[model samples]
Target: MREFDYDLFVIGGGSGGVRAARVAAGETGAKVGLAEESRYGGTCVIRGCVPKKLMVFASEFSGLSEDAGLYGWDVTGGAFDWGRFSTRLNGELDRLEGVYRKLLSASGVDTFDCRATLKDPHTVSLANGEEKTAKHILVATGGRPVRPDMNNADLGMVSDDIFHQETLPKSILIVGGGYIACEFACILHGLGVEVTLYYRGAQILRGFDEEARGLIAESMRERGIDLHIGTNIVEMDCAGSDDSDTGMGGPIQDTGETVGDSGMSHRGRQSGDTSDGPIRVKATNGSSRVFDRVLFATGRRPNTDGMGLEELGVKLGRGGQIEVDAYSQTAVPSIYAIGDVTDRVNLTPVAIREGMAFVETVFKGNPTPVDHALIPSAVFTQPELGTVGMNEEDAREQEEIDVYCTSFRPMQTAFIGKPDRVLMKLIVSKANRKVLGCHIVAPNAGEMIQLAGIAIKMGATKEDFDRTVAVHPTMSEEIVTMRNPVRSA
Candidate 1:
């Protein structure tokens, strides 16, 4: 057999790639090499999860100050300094990136600061014109935010660009109904930006529980976010251009230009000025407006372009996601993939888990298949939502379910005369009494669901939760105290 330069080659310095490389090299003493074209920490640490959560924490203070005033404290709200916060946030991310690099180096994994692509099944080519071969190759390039293919789409910024903005916009128009859009809408609104949200769908957060989403929508509106449902941006142009003069009154005409088979558009030439000016937007709901900035949190696509995977006969989905088996192995037995590139449960923690599983399966001689079910997730809106397992809508479709739900004003907000309400729902399987789902919509819902997730994951039933004693004077106590089912279907 031909000797390869390394035992395993990981292309991508993101969480999955880094984890797999470090573990395989450190634990199994494999000759591992990894490459990262961009920042080492990937999306979650660099721009996606960490920085976003910091902004969420900053956004909460505005409300906290108001509640403090109600508690007889002379509290006052101050102006938000985006520059200071952004600087601090960037410094923290840089520190984290250094930590990731240190971990890889300590594990004896050869790190390449350049891009890596496949030369063949066994050979990897780096951007620095170096080619090295490995016994096994792993792809974990991850994904990128996608903008809609409309007129002047490039004029709008994606989620990744939000971190790099020099200053927060005075007013912003956020498009899309997903968690990203809603979270930013709330975050920016809290930071004193005149925020407006437009979702083409009838409601935001389409896949979540209906009751939970309904309350979120109500809270967002109450918090002064101008939300428009069943609407989308048909055209966008820079202010003070010929295209910008298009009347604000009629519904936007459909371009009829279909998205190609690749599900992405060849980015069109940008029109109008690209300076610091308002952007003119015409919506499908027959309205026109100009905003300081437009953010397209529309969606994301797998980062599998121009990697030579297709030519190598690796099966790819329509979205450019790498097709892999339970073992994360591709058709080419020596090749494997994990994380968002595989498009399996696109969460940061899930990617890390998949990476660990990949290392165990390939190097440790323990065949491990990644578990993708019942993963806990949270959306950091004004009133956050945390969920695990199947939602009520999906659970009812699969089996007979009894939903035990409660929505009431929490003690903290009720005491302050704030109209904030919380929701706790448990979807129980009627036949087996197993808790099919646990969904919480409240402040600190994310923290609450982490513990609740453990029970539901262990096949906890309604009786199991009921038997547990309640924590007094707490919102979570309702999860254990609700005895009867609200409805069954």
Candidate 2:
């Protein structure tokens, strides 16, 4: 082997890449070099989740004036300067980038700003034509937004592009059926925009507990969002300027192709430029609508492009994700991948864990497997939805499971006299009574699930949750005090 400059070389300085670099170089005392084409903090920190949620908070306050009046506050119609909010998100992100830099530097890992492309199995070439070699090359370049293949998609935007939008769009048509799509629906709705969310399916979210999905849909409608659950966006027309008929002339798709034994392919997604009152949308049944701005919150594809791993014989799996074993090792012995690049579980924390594990197994010589079974996720809608472990439907479909679920109006709603409702459900194994899943839809449900996740992962049962003392004056108490229960539902 040639004498190399570093022990481990990483491409893409996102959550996983930076973490692995830090642990391997600092803790394991290995010489590590990290190459990043973008910001150090990666997608979740830079453009994906953090800044987007910040925008959500800003947008939500735009309509809060209406609710404040109910609490004996006086206010009139108000306007929000979205440019100002975008600036704030950017400033905060700039500070975050500095912190990531400091953290990586303190770990003694060298950083490269140019793009990295693997030449041979172990050699990497930079964009500026600098060649470097390492014993191991880790591909942690997370995912990127998939813009529609319509005319001037460049004019349209994806979830990542919306973080630092030039200005707030008065009306937005978001496309896709995923958590990001639903989360964006709630965020943009809260932000006081005429937001119309289009999901190709009968519902918005997929892979979530179905009951919670229904609750979210209802909550979004209650919060005044124009949600079209069984619809899609076929094409976006940006010929006019941002101000010219802000909602005019966008095409929709008619997915005439039926779902086969596997699923429907893009070949069946036919396009029709039918207009819907100046906004743009596409229905499965030959329909079209229009909007001011378009957001493809649909999903993300790994940033495995232009970073030459294919020629280097790196393996990739489903959805163009870099292939890795339990410890995140790639097909090539020295190459490994983590985070969205690996696409195992495309969450921020999961990538961080993979990064930590990669160091342990590769550098420390003591391997640790990534446990993804009980990973938790939160959709920060106006009323949040949080879940961990096997959901009721998933548990039932996968294995024989007992369902213990209850939902009721919180005390806040009783006093406020609002039509909002909070639902909580638990799925336990019929064979052993171990808590298989926990789902909640309420204010701060995400935060409540954080503590409950531990108990669920520890194999707690319905009886244990029932026996636990309730904390007064909190919505979380409902989790432990579920009065009604059915054996099987």
Candidate 3:
């Protein structure tokens, strides 16, 4: 008899777990069992990238008519219908979850639809009071959005709650400056909501290239996002919760709208909105205002609580991320992890790559290590920010470098007298003329960066880029045509 019931048992049905389970079972002919407490597709498909990107697309339509009018087309725009868009978005998520299930079944992997915890190094206990033994256990429980720790903070919603909002608020106060906060600030503004963003920092998108993030911040303000730097909410309470005056103004009057079955009243007021009214917020700048909703896109933490990991001697980092080796193996052999749980690279593609590498090392015996260098990523803010490799500041600190950058109004929007501008920048090493980094800020920047990522990954030099012919009349062509370094650092 075999020592364990299965060769491999996976936890969390997110992208990383699903990919590893399917590949191991189908290709290596290993017995695999997988469990998921929530939806199969996890954050990206159900509540994150997929749904959020669709919302971004829906939000962009609020400006299409004006741009079309400039091009001599009489296109009329209508009020955004949140109900109609949300219905279709949920339908797409359902279809995707079904697809994830079908793939696992086709691979002959045993699937359990419940929460799982480690009973021991090689044992898994399911929520249904069942135990499964495997020769190996892979944890890819993923991460979750978290709210800040402050009084009455629970009243605010997180990124996950944004998807389930039955209707868009008339006005929202978003607290943070990360990609999630910035993206939604732009998204809600485009969808016709009054968006006020408060960040307790000098600038937004802190770790990104300074020039790129500066342009994004300027563009957000130009597009009507009331972005305030070095400011944050000092206090917040539901309107009329306290009778004391805020000094700037007295208590806000109730709208007298009856709460609906969805807990929201007339229009897009929140469940927190009572007969007394919406939420009242006091900012660090001592200004007070009322908002229909308050969203906290502060940050995310790995899902590792009560998983029986620490008991088995698995090391967890300060951020609660599982500490794993080059092959994604934990301190205890026979246990592994990947994806957001590891916190190496939080992107979906990075997790998938880590999973495949884990399989290659353990199942295939080829001992492959995860390759995380030169990964390209994008921030889906208005006039999206796409970047690959080091930024100018970091490159300059490490070695002498040349920075080539240009910003100009693109032809399409320029002809219409629109003020939209596109940026193309490259950071090159002075020693070998290697293109150390590339950053683009414009529409579809994410798509352009993927093709550029290939050349950077192959160690393409500045001369190599110069030798390549430019695609005329394209914003990306600036990358190849710029003959001189605008500045050196």
Please write out the lDDT profile of model 3 over residues 315-346, one tens digit for every residue. Answer: 99997889999999999999999988887888
Off by over 4 Å in 1: 244-275
Give per-residue CA lDDT, model 1, range 101-175, as digits (tens): 999999999988887788799999999999989999999888877767665766777777778878889999988
Model 3's alpha-carbon lDDT is 0.85
Worst 10 residues of 1 by lDDT: 255-264
How many pairs of residues collide in each model? 0, 11, 0
Cα lDDT of model 2 by residue, 359-442, tens digit: 888888888988888987787777888889987777887777777667677886566668888888888777887888999898
TM-score of 1: 0.94
* Per-candidate alpha-carbon RMSD to the true structure: 4.1, 6.1, 6.3
**How high is the lDDT of residue 92 in model 3?**
94
The CA-based lDDT of model 1 is what?
0.85
Q: How much RMSD separates candidate 2 from the native structure?
A: 6.1
List residue ranges in candidate 3 displaced over 4 A.
Answer: 243-277
